[model samples]
Target: MTGITDFTVKGADGGSVSLADYAGQVLLIVNTASKCGFTPQYAGLEALHRDYAERGFAVLAFPCNQFGAQEPGDAAEIASFCSLTYDVTFPVFARVDVNGGSADPLFDRLKADAPGVLGTKAIKWNFTKFLVDRAGHTVARHAPTTKPEDLRAEIEALL
Candidate 1:
C-alpha cells in the first residue's frame, strides 16, 4: 500500500520534497489557506511544530485554493503570509488542489487511507488535517474545524 513515503511534493520554494525525507517522524499534514476562516489556526499549528519538533513531530502545510479562492497567492506570497503572520517554521508545500481530479497525489492517498465523516474521501475544507505516524501510515483525519491545539494528545502518543 502507498504510504506517505511513496509520494513526492513540491515545496513553496519550487524545490521537490519527498515524503521519505520526513519518514520516522509523526506528521500533521494540513491543507492551508491564508484568507480562510481557519487562517488563524496557523498559529496553533506553528505552536505544535515548535512544541514537538524536538520529539519527532512536524506540521507540513500545503496551501490550497480550491475551497473559495481564499488562497489566491503565489508561492512567495503564501510563504510570506505564513511567516509574517504565524511565524511558521515548518515546511510549506506548493499550492495544490486538495479535491477533484487535480488534487495532489499525496492528498489522494491520504484521503483514501483515512476517509472523513460517513466514509467520504473528499476533503471538506481548508485546515483539514491528516495525521501520519512515524512509519508513514496515515492514522487519522481531522475536519477543518478541529483546532490544531486539540491534537496534542494524539501527537504526543505518536511521539
Candidate 2:
C-alpha cells in the first residue's frame, strides 16, 4: 500500500519536493483554480492553515488549469494571485494536470487512495481536496463544492 510519502511534487518555485517532507503533519491537499466559482474558497483554506498550522496541520495548494482553463497563469502569477488576493500563506505548488495521462503523480496517488462519487478516481473539477493524516494515509475526499470551512471539525479531530 503506497502512502502519500511515496510521491514527489513540484513546488511553485519549480523545485522538486517529496511528500515525505510533510510526513507526520495533517495535510489538506487541494487542486485549485483562480478563475473558478469556488476560487473564494482560498479564504477558507487560508483560515484553516492559520488556525491549525502551529498544531501540525498544513494546506497544500496545487493550481490546475485542466478545468475550463480557469488557472492559466504561470507559477509566479498563481503565487502572486493567491498571496495578494487572499493572503494565502500556505504552500502552493506549480501548476499541473489533475486528470488525464499528463496528471501529476502526486494526484494520481491521491485519487487512487480515495476515489470519489461511486469509486471513480478521475477528478471532476478544480478545488477537489484530499485530507491526509499525520501518518501520510489519505483519510477523506472532498468535492470541489465542499467548502474548506466545512472540514474544520474533521481537521480538528485529526489534529
Candidate 3:
C-alpha cells in the first residue's frame, strides 16, 4: 500500500526528507499558516510533540499560503517565525499547496486515505490535520477547529 512512508517531502532547508525516516511513529500531519486565526495551535502541537515524542509520536507541520495568503513568508522567514513566536521544535516543512492541482502528493494521498466531512478529498483550510498510526495508516482527518490537545487519547491509543 502507498502509505505516508512511501513519500518524500521538502524540508525547511529545501532538501528532500524521506517520510520513511518517520516510519513506525504516530504522526499528526498538519498544514499550517503563520497569520491564520489557528496559528496559536502551534503551541498545542508542540506540546503534543514534547509530551509524546518518547513514545514514538510526532507532529509534522507544513506551512501553506493557499488559504487567504496567510503564510506569505519564505522558508527562512517561516522557520524564524515558528521559532521566535512559538518555540516549536517539531519538524516544520517547506510551504505547500494542500488542495487543487498543485497540491503536494503526500497530502493528496492523505486526503484520499481519510477524506474530510462528507467524504471530501480537498483540504478546507489551514491547520487541517491527518493522524497516522505507526503502520502509516491514516487514522483520522481533523478540521482546523479541532484542538491539538483534544487528540491526546487517540494518539495514546496508537502508542
Give the Cα error of residue 16 in candidate 1, in Å. 1.2
Root-mean-square deviation per candidate: 0.7, 0.8, 0.5
Tens-digit per-residue lDDT, 1-159, candidate 1: 767987889988888888898889999999999999999999999999999999999999999999989999999999999999889999999999989999999999999999998999999999999999999999999998999999999999999
Q: Candidate 1: misplaced stretches above 4 Å?
A: none
Q: Per model, how many backbone clashes are there?
A: 0, 0, 0
Compute each candidate's TM-score over C-alphas.
Answer: 0.98, 0.97, 0.99
Query: Which digits, one per residue and each the tens of the lDDT, describe model 3 over residues 1-159?
Result: 878988999999999999999999999999999999999999999999999999999999999999999999999999999999999999999999999999999999999999998999999999999999999999999999999999999999999
Cα displacement (Å) at residue 41, model 2:
0.2
Error of 2 at 89 (Å): 0.4
As a TM-score, model 2 comes out at: 0.97
Per TM-score, the best of the predicted structures is 3
Range of the 10 consecutive residues with the lowest summed lDDT in candidate 1: 1-10
Answer with 2 or 3, whichever has the higher lDDT.
Answer: 3
Clashing residue pairs in candidate 2 are none
Instruction: Arrange candidates by TM-score, descending.
Output: 3, 1, 2
